[model samples]
Structure formats: structure tokens, C-alpha cells
Target: MTAATQTPMLAARNLSCVRGTQTLFTDLSLQLDAGQWLYLQGENGAGKTSLLRILAGLALPAAGSVHWQAQPISNQRSEYHADMLYLGHHASLKEDLTLTENLRSLIAMDGLKVSDAAIQDALTRMGLAKRQHLPARVLSAGQKRRGLLVRLLLRPAKLWLLDEPFNALDANAIVDLQECLKAHLKDGGMIVLTSHQTPDLGSDTAGFVLSLSRGRA
Candidate 1:
């Protein structure tokens, strides 16, 4: 395709967000292609999560538009969402369900066809091999986060939108996450994430940072 007609993997143009009387950001734009990641950085209450929600199609921007493969996200909600995965800061788990059961159900909710063996392997890789049978209520915060991260192993989404993915992670878990991210980028996946801690996706991955402050980015 010619350069002028080429579509970006993801693009946000002149986005504006307002909560109550406060305008969090205005006229912000971003573009990401395969093998690239964008990091969202800001202080407390800078609308990082709000911006992520907008990009995920969970919330509406006050102005401007978001496009997936050059189509407005609102116009292609299902197709766009099918290729995107959004994970909030908190782990979404059923307190009464075991980690294994929770992972199974979550994958099912996405309509993914993953085998039990794959789930087991992902759990083991996340360092929850022994704890997979334990209820989420009994696991530590870090373990719960790891359980949620197992989706990254099973889901084949082209774009990943994560909010505070590194929260509650230990040193080893952090390293593991970095490796996972590196692999995702290597496979030509796009990622947008909000985090207080800077991510080290090694030296090869192309990563950019968008710093958000009150009413601007």
C-alpha cells in the first residue's frame, strides 16, 4: 500500500477528556504500530486510567476520535474489541474460585478456545503452579495479579491496554513481565499502558512515553 493510504495499527486524534468540572486532557494525539509500545506516565489523578478507558472503548472522549486500523472505534466496536485486550489495575478474579478455575472462566468470557493444558502451563510459568488450586481469596495481592497476567499467555490480541500492570509484583515477577512484553512486541503486537514505574522492554523494542498532566498531555 502507498504511504498516504496506509492505516496505522492504532491512532488517537485530538482526544479530550473531562470529569465533572475538571478537564483532564485536551487535544492529545497518539499513534502506535506493530512492534511498538506506548507508556502513559503521570502523577496521581492525571487521568491516566481515564485515557486508557477511552482507548479501550469503555469510556467516551469529550472530543476527537480513536481509530483502530484507520476505522473509528465506535464504527467497528466488535472487530476492534476482538483484537484488543484491556486489563485494569485490579485483578478481576472470583474470590471463591481457585486460580485455575478463575483463569478458565476468564478465558471463556473472552470466547477463547484454550486448552486446560495451556492454562496449566501459563499458571506454572507465572509461578503459580502450586497455588493454582487455591482460592483467590487466599492468595497474596501479587499472586492474584500474576493470575490475571496469565491472559497474556493465552490471548492472541493484537493490542494490549494495561493499567498499572506492574503493581504488586515482586522482582522476579517484574522480570518475567518484562520478558513477556518483549516477546509480545517481537511478534508485532501493540501495547499502551499506564504505570508509575518505568518498564524495561530491553533495548530493541520501540517504546514511547506520553506524560499526562492536568488538562494536557
Candidate 2:
């Protein structure tokens, strides 16, 4: 294959974190190539969210570095962000804005614009078509999860860092998202996420998981 077609890779080395003098974890390292889905598993207080935050560049690792395509992400901040997407446990949507409005604003932040029809379609697929006009504050926790997931359909990225992505999704919504992830992997996207629910991807895909616990005993 040509260089243009080669998939990208994300790597992290010697990552560690601390919370109020409590050492979470250390010496963590991993690499994810395009078309791979990484699942993070751990008990509560195992620093799963903290690890995801560091990898997403939302937080600094106490003693490590992250790289994309062999280049330190810090040296290429904007370029890295342009191709990376991070979705925290919270929806990150504005309660004052309707579903479509929130999505519109998110896209605009990336210097892109989508039509109302496009926004509605994404919401419809995520089972939020009926609530597209409703303010986000009125949506239940589950609905808020689905609403935030609608962003995935609206924007495509090379790397996705999701924390507890399947937390509030229902049976059908979970299935829909699993399929969406499979397709993203098929398209050579790299996803490093934390999900308690085991995603059922087709046999044709490649993925793995890393379990996080406390520091070495």
C-alpha cells in the first residue's frame, strides 16, 4: 500500500497519575494502530477515567508522553486535536440548546458546518429524532447519553477516547453503537475507550483490552 493509505497509530509510554496523594497507577504503556478497538477494564477507583483523560490530552500524565504517528502529540497540538475526539462520561451538551443546536455548535467549533437535515438525521438514528427540538436538560440520563453519541455520526475522527461509553445506552442503542464502532474500525479508525459492556463486533475486526488496577504491590 502507498504511504497515503497506511493507517496511523497512537502510543503512550510510562503513563502515571496521582489524585490527592493517592497513587493511582504507573508504568502504563500501550500502542493502538488504526482499525483497532481498545477496551479498558478495572475495578472502581482504578484510574480508568484518569488514564483516558491523559491519553486524550485533556490531562497531563505525571510521568509519560503520548505520541501520534511517531510524533509527540504536544508538539503537534492543534493537528492532533483536529483528528482526535474525546467524549467524557458527561454529555458535554448545553442544557439550554436543543439536540440539533448542540450538534451544530460542536461542528462549528471544528470549523465545519452541517445542515439542519444532517443533524436531525443523526439524532433520528440515535433514537433522539423526537426530542431533537427539546432542550437537553429535559432529557433523561439515558437520553443524554444517546444525544451525545449522536456526535459520532456527525463527525468522523482518527482517534476516539471514550469513558464508559455504554453507561446509559439501552439494548437497541447499544447494538447500534457497537455496529457504528465496527464500521469505524473497518474504515481504519483507532478507538481507545472504557466500556463495561462487552461490544460484539464482527469476526473480521481486530481489537484488544487492557485492565487497570492499582500500583504494583
Index of the highest-lDDT prediction: 1
Model 1 agreement with the true structure over 1-217: per-residue lDDT tens digits: 1123367889889999999999999999888988999999999999999999999999999999999999999999889988999999878999999998998888888787789999999999999999988899999999999999998988889999999999999999999999999999999998999988999998888888889987778
lDDT of every predicted structure (CA atoms): 0.91, 0.84
Tens-digit lDDT string for candidate 2 (1-217): 1123243488887888888898898878788887887888888888989988888888898888998888988999888988898999988999999988888998999887788888888888888889989999999999999988888888868888888889888888888998898888888997888877776777787777788877631
Worst 10 residues of 1 by lDDT: 1-10
- Candidate 2 total steric clashes: 0
TM-score between model 2 and native: 0.93
